[model samples]
Target: MTRRRRTACILAALGAGVAITQTACGGGTPSAAPSTSYDATVRADSPALYLSLGAGGPKKQKQSAVALKATYHHAPGVTSMPNGDRASLFDGTSQYVEIPDDDRLSVTTTGELTVEAWIRPDALTFAKTDGAGYVNWLGKVSSEEARTEWLARMYSRDNSEARANRISGYVFNEGGGLGAGSYFEDRVRPGEWIHYALVINTREKSDAYPTGYVKVYKNGVLRDQDALDGYDIVPSNTDAPMRIGTAAAKSYFKGAIGKVAVYDSEVPESRLAAHCRAMHGTPREAAGT
Candidate 1:
């Protein structure tokens, strides 16, 4: 049936307290490059979860992962415009979702990790008011210690220079508690299926921190890349479920989320390409009905 409904059904069957893992597809050619694939845990007879945004949403692919508790699609504290259909999760005081519901996946990792998702970004209404648009892709917890690391997420903002240049990408580290660090922008459009990733590699050193990076792919092709070497942030454990819609209460995403995949290791380009090719029609990054 529909993607959301299919996932819901699978979640129902699997029941709570069951730990679902992302595994390799059976009989499928092993990706030449290193990659990790995640599918929802289901009964052998259950259908696949392969739904997307535009059409009836994503469909049920044979391999899909069930979302755990506190995974909110639309909760309170966030506002949705009249024309929008999806609900966002902004804190009552701020316009962002940077913290977890109960601080479940706040562990720090010592090595590399990857983040992926299918997002339809909405208009940046709070850009002017807060000087920061929506950055609900992903985020880490707030650190009280000055030496604590950070792994924030990306979002889009309006460029006053050009009307067509309506969207861009940026990140905030915990160094300044969401105020410090260099904030970059992307020359991309909103309301479409875009693939974005943040890869942290390299070893930590006394002189310099390990090298990390950020990249954006429009419909599968790599459009932007950033080398964030010397920056270090504690990562969540392998068991931590990836946050899709909103990272915290303040930076809730204002759009429809179709699919999300998390790999313990870096995902190969071939697999990413396959996922991009599987994508269907365009989706507006608008609030939900």
Candidate 2:
């Protein structure tokens, strides 16, 4: 069976409370599943991806909950969270995760897309080849020869020349041009976990032809929205890989990344909050620290 079909069957069996058993082939021992109930809950969410970084070795870190294999660049290390969960730490130079380009990841003009993650930065400022700059937490883009498709980045008011600490989201067209974008000027505290989510609804009606709407959510609250401008807000297809912890080596993220999720459809605000609560505990719990 195909991977998607097998995943569906596994979820169905789990929903039905069927006890699953497996036999080792060729006299090899069967691999053990996650031991915690919370892990099971996360797996059942069925995100297009659920990457639990720093929870395991490099090989296992690349394994997605939905079976999509990811690759690590420059070898990020594991770190501990306040809740005892592990997170992958990126060094501002050359650490990030790369997800191979796939058709499912390419957002079209009529498709809905959601990207969410939990991040804790060491510092907002980093030195680049040209000069000092901020970091892009996650994004997908063509090679330097091509334009960026989308990016969720952290920048400063002075455009990284100085540290003002702002978070922004951008959507681009095929030729690597900006389409729709917005930024939140909230100050990001170092070493504190924050939930970030971005939703894109390309089917929404807009005055601009062939463009759609975008929303930025920080910790379950809507922070910004804008209508995409370009005629090709998102290409019908792309072969550019989705990147985490950096975008095309420009702004490498320097911090710990816990959970990363992608949904083919826009997730409800309530549901997004619930997911954050599940992964990071309550806001009250966070404030206590």
Report the number of clashing residue pairs per model: 39, 1
lDDT agreement with native, every candidate: 0.35, 0.64
- lDDT tens digits, residue span 1-289, model 1: 7966754543333223323211122213212222222222111112212222222212212223333322333332322211122324333232332223222222233343444455445444333221245443444433232322333344444424333323322233444343212233444433333444443432333333334454444444455554444233333333222344434434445544444333434444555555543222111231111
User: Which candidate has the highest TM-score of all?
Assistant: 2
Model 1 alpha-carbon drift over 4 Å, by segment: 1-67, 73-110, 124-131, 142-156, 159-190, 203-212, 230-243, 281-289
TM-score of 1: 0.48
Candidate 2 wrongly placed segments (more than 4 Å)? 1-45, 55-66, 129-132, 145-147, 156-163, 206-210, 230-232, 282-289
| Residue 126 lDDT (model 2) | 55
Clashes of 1: 39
Q: Give per-residue CA lDDT, model 2, range 172-230, as digits (tens).
A: 77676545777677766666667788887777665743467778887667778887754
TM-score of each: 0.48, 0.75
